[model samples]
Target: METKSIVLLFIMTAFLTACAGNSKKTVQMAAKPIMKKHHSVVSQYPMSLPPPVVESRMRTVEDVVNNFGPYATGQLKPYFRKAGVAYPPREVTFIALKQEKKLEVWARDGGEFRFIRDYDVKAASGVTGPKLWQGDKQVPEGVYRIVGLNPNSNYHLSMKLNYPNEFDWFHAQREGRFDPGSDIFIHGNSVSAGCLAMGDEAIEELFVLTAQVGEENVKVIIAPRDPRLLPLDPEGYGLPSWTPELYRMIAAEMEGFSDAVKVSNNRPFYPASSPLR
Candidate 1:
């Protein structure tokens, strides 16, 4: 009886030991895939780092402009003083009106922007509408920003706009549109297919100003017309259903800079000697 009891106890202890070992193995096996998945995810999308500072040795758009004709920094000094802003403004906003053919430049002063100057758009294709497709010959009417600075451009010095932004992409995706087209620029030359042609002289100043202020700090607002002065009437024209809503969205953004225009009345603030021709 004693031998049988000891044998039963021994069997129970062996069984419990086996069960514990199996449990540990199972846990390790389960954790292997989880650890692998974590590693895979980390490898797939590594953390993004901030952009590196511009190297002094690398030739910049500002350096190129300085070597050209008039120095943009020198030309912008008087205008900056009149607007009560620092030289080579920290932030710059460009309001491009399609119908009016005007490009208003505003510089940041303290918390608000100060009206700088207006440049005439030498030429722009399409009448008055947002660009929807390739070869549409339409100048897009939306909020944009300077994304690229092309010193070696066919149309002289040019600054590229990030067209088809997140909003544009969303609309295109919703409509199942594939080719929205791209390469929109505020370039030089009087001839343009679907770009804002500000002429050679105008682009030089703009290009330099953009480079100096940093492209990330520049904002470009393209509108069908000056929404502040003229009301947008999509009903008046045969247009897409989304046109009116788009106009209202643009008007809302324009409202933020309304005070800048009011203070300067959309007139060139530079002195007579330093006129924006």
Candidate 2:
């Protein structure tokens, strides 16, 4: 009976030992997954540098060019060829004329810029004037720059605009208007609330061109009207009090491009010629 009891006691101790070993092993197993996840995964909000610069992008700039470059180049190369300018000139300027709903492309050729081509704005939002506050639905007017290029845009692809720029912020701050809206872009698709919609084909061309020219090499100007034609008379326009000064600045800047020989809306647009484009 004593021998039988010893054997039973040994079995109980062995069973306890096995349970303890399993508990430790289960903890190790649970911890292993957490360690692997921490080391090998991206966070919910990825803080890494954007891809092509990094290895994170499932799609890269090369993919965009390959997918859309052929068609864009097909349409764009001719314009450059006709201008006697090399494709992807040194720099490019885009002028957005709100009243006429036209976006003109200009390229730097020897020392001055020349008119390359123009694209019809697919859609526009708001009336004439500058965007002031959030939800104002007014297209911003001023010299702007491309802030970024988005490939996964809901509207195909989009070029981000630096709206609420220093000029915008200065006015908004003076008027006590915080939240002077943002996320403005020149994107594809014929829809806009306060952005420039440049359709699929046009945006694709722009996207490819911008990627080639380098965002820093691109400039943008949004104007209320063709200041080169009709005088920018800010009188009685009932905008901001300082708007006349603004109109003068816009008109003066436009005079630089007054010489570009072009046809707008199938109508001849011949402004007084300037040495500049």
Candidate 3:
């Protein structure tokens, strides 16, 4: 009976030892660090220096020449000659007039931009106003820059615009807004929801020109009207209270390209002379 009791006690002790070992293992697991998911904007979406996607799709001068060789040589070269500007200008400016339905291309001259060509904005949704929020359908009226170039675009070749610039962001944040829609572009196809639709031929010229000049050196100015001729009437347009200040800022920038229209007076260099087929 004593021997049997000893064997039973040994079995119980072994069971408790096994349980203790499992408990210790459980405690170790609980002590292990729990990885918390990062939520900060910078952490979640780390800024990539020399963004890989942009670099991969970046167009070369040869690419531009190959795609738009004829137009660049036959048409654009003569236009630049007449404007007294060099071909493949060091810098380029795009002025988009919503009311006039015009998109003017300009090249850097001695001190200012000289007009190169003006293409009709085949179609653009919304009236004369700044794009307030996503789905507002308003063509944004502000200074923007070319942020991307898509050679293989659904709407033919397209040049993406940097909308919601610093000013746009500041106002949006102040107004407690988020998700101010994007993907604005100057593209081919004579149809638009809230973008500049400059037809196939026009977009090809623009795309080639932008590719040659380098997207970083291209500046885009979008406005309700020719600010130089007809000044912005905030009240007349029934714009927000803060718009007058914004208009003033845009007007100041527009003043720098006042002489751009002179290229229109130079008839010999007009696009009609050597139209892009």
Candidate 4:
């Protein structure tokens, strides 16, 4: 029994538990089918694109924008106003802390980034670490860009990410994992295979905001946890050996947002009396 237990423990530790590879294919999110089922919400937050899957047959970016643009834009006005920025800032940054299950939205117009709002991740798969291959179910942890937008997504609307970026490819090539999965996204809905599910309300705001600001100007930085608040201890998790280097890169970019809510929203990410600082 003792020996069996030890073997099982080793297997668990060796298992690469994470899922960043969505779409299950050769890159484009379009290649994946739009999920038939929906998990629309009703509360202070409602669904972005409601079901019967009204937009199921609907295609084209313009069609999506026309359908949901006004609603999304209207809803976002107050947030941008509260953040003291224009309707569409010059740029935006999305920071995801996987362990915290939180996503922070920051905006700027030729100045420092100011917190706009934060959202619950709703659903994401896998453990902490960079997405090494397809179906690992791990969320990729690194600096990335909004490569494209998917108006018709399996999990409602979604914004595509450049997961296998230069860093991802370089590492994969070295490691010799040729098919390092693709079609990663931050989409709506409450189910995730290897994508960040931001739910309906959040995705509408994000999707609309991304379109308004233009995809090129949007940057995404995903990390395991907020290093500023509490650094990650590699010893505690079943992660790869190269994780430290990847974390350092994430930390450097995150430095600008350490005082996250201060510049605009005034919602401090950390409590004033907290000892973690």
Candidate 5:
């Protein structure tokens, strides 16, 4: 009986020891940081584009403005002051030229669109039209969001946009092909194979603009031409038939964009703020 009891005790001790060892191993494994499936330095920010996906970086003002004259001067100042952005948010505008296959930004107050500057691009596999499908070889049309931004990236600085939004996904789902790549960005001038690219300087300006707008305020308008009608006479420009439709669509979509800002005759004004001021 004594021997039997002793054997039972030994067995219990061995079992407990094994359990303790297993617990330690489990804890060590749990302590390891789990990596995201596509985590990158440039994809760190929640809004804006990053270089990890786009392969772009920030550049100085001289590179963007001195080379390309701005569409409007000092227009960026209000946004800069309002957002307390460092450097001069005082003079910058983003230009997306479908015909030129280029996306550039310039610093200016206003005068002429001589800001004929050009930025580097990665792989652009689209034409001057709206992207309809995943493998359509066309960049998207309409306004989109820079929902993600990152400073550290596999390529360089970059900002990420919520490409293939709900509308895009819905369309894809209907076609029974849901395997769309989600990491599209406005990154450094690298080969996209299917993405848009902007030079380092232009991206920097974009970063500043996005930071000021709180990402939510950042609006990307890819149009056929500059809307200001600087080079062409507004009356004689003879816009395409699709132009009016597009404009109306945008205006309708922007309706009720701001609950506080009231629109009277297609103009927006903040009623909460005093008119006396």
Candidate 6:
């Protein structure tokens, strides 16, 4: 009888040990998954760079370009016409000059074809080309930003461009001259001092498109001439006329821009006159 009691006591002690081990192991196993999820949440929303509060906000031109196609069915329908060449509709496009006195919109994704939209422009006092000097009453050129929409303007509607960029200010300082009256725009029918003018309907459409995409995301490219007319090769244009020192400085700036934006173009290497096929 004593031997039987000893065996039964051993079994009970062993069972209790097993239960204790399992309880510790189960707690550790459950904690691992919880800890993993906690780490993931922390890594995704670090304090240094918090995630955007609103995911739908448009922060870049690329975002706007990629999304503009889906918004075309509304008032923007008129801007859509059958494409002339074999090209997919692009998201990021530029409308510069057209034979129909219109703007040509091209897409980054659309391979090669450009869409043409008729627009009326008020050229500076004399020409249809890019404005070079201040007070030439000419539109300032460079990569610009369209920031606001003016509904109560003398014109039907107007969108603002952030012009007179850093380069312009530098040039002005170097030349010891300041060009007065520099508020240029892509606006409505009240003839401009030197802004691009579109009809009321066109401006309204542009306003809607730009507003949907967010003003800060739009970039305006004002060139001496449309780049489509220039050559595409990077190695062939005769080098720019600059002293060794100036060339190095310019090349450095170009390199920095390329690195920051990951865009490489041959146009900078050649004169704007070279024909590109």
TM-scores for all candidates? 0.71, 0.74, 0.70, 0.72, 0.43, 0.47
lDDT of each: 0.81, 0.82, 0.78, 0.80, 0.49, 0.50
Candidate 3 segments whose C-alpha is farther than 4 A from its true place: 1-65, 259-277
Q: lDDT tens digits, residues 1-277, model 6?
A: 9999999999999999999999999999999999999888788998677666775542343443344435533545444444343222334333433112334343333344234343444432323333446566655545567766665556766777766666556655676557634667787673656676776666665765666556654556544333343322223233222223332333332231121111222222234443311
TM-score: which candidate is best? 2
Name the runs in model 5 displaced over 4 angstroms: 1-95, 102-123, 132-137, 223-277
* Per-residue C-alpha lDDT of model 4 across residues 104-209, encoded as one tens digit per residue: 8888887788777789888878776789888887788899999898887888899999989998999898889998889899999988777899999889889988
Candidate 5 residues 173-276, lDDT tens each?
A: 77665765466677665555345666565565565555544566454544333333212112213333344555444344333233122122232222211111
Error of 5 at 82 (Å): 16
| Clash statistics: count for each candidate | 0, 0, 0, 9, 35, 1
Instruction: Please identify which of the two predictions, 2 or 6, would achieve the higher TM-score against the true structure.
Output: 2
lDDT of 1 at 126: 83
lDDT of 4 at 48: 69
- What's the distance in Å from true for residue 151, model 4? 1.2
Question: Cα RMSDs of all predictions?
Answer: 15.0, 7.6, 10.2, 25.0, 17.4, 18.5
Ordered from best to worst TM-score, the candidate numbers read 2, 4, 1, 3, 6, 5
lDDT for each residue of candidate 3 in 1-277, tens digit (9 for 90 to 100): 9999999999999999999999999987776533233233346566663323534665554675696867756667888888789978999989887876788888884567877777888988877667878888778889999998887778878889999898888888888778776888999998887899999888888888887788999999997777766577776546766788888988998887764464446422222112111
Model 3: worst 10 consecutive residues (lDDT sum):
268-277
Output the worst ten-in-a-row residue range by lDDT, candidate 1. 268-277
Where in model 6 is the C-alpha error above 4 Å?
1-73, 78-93, 98-101, 106-124, 128-134, 230-277
lDDT tens digits, residues 193-265, model 1? 7899999888888888887788999999998777776577666455666888888889988887764454546
Could you tell me the lDDT of residue 150 within candidate 6? 68
- Model 1: CA > 4 A from native: 1-62, 259-277
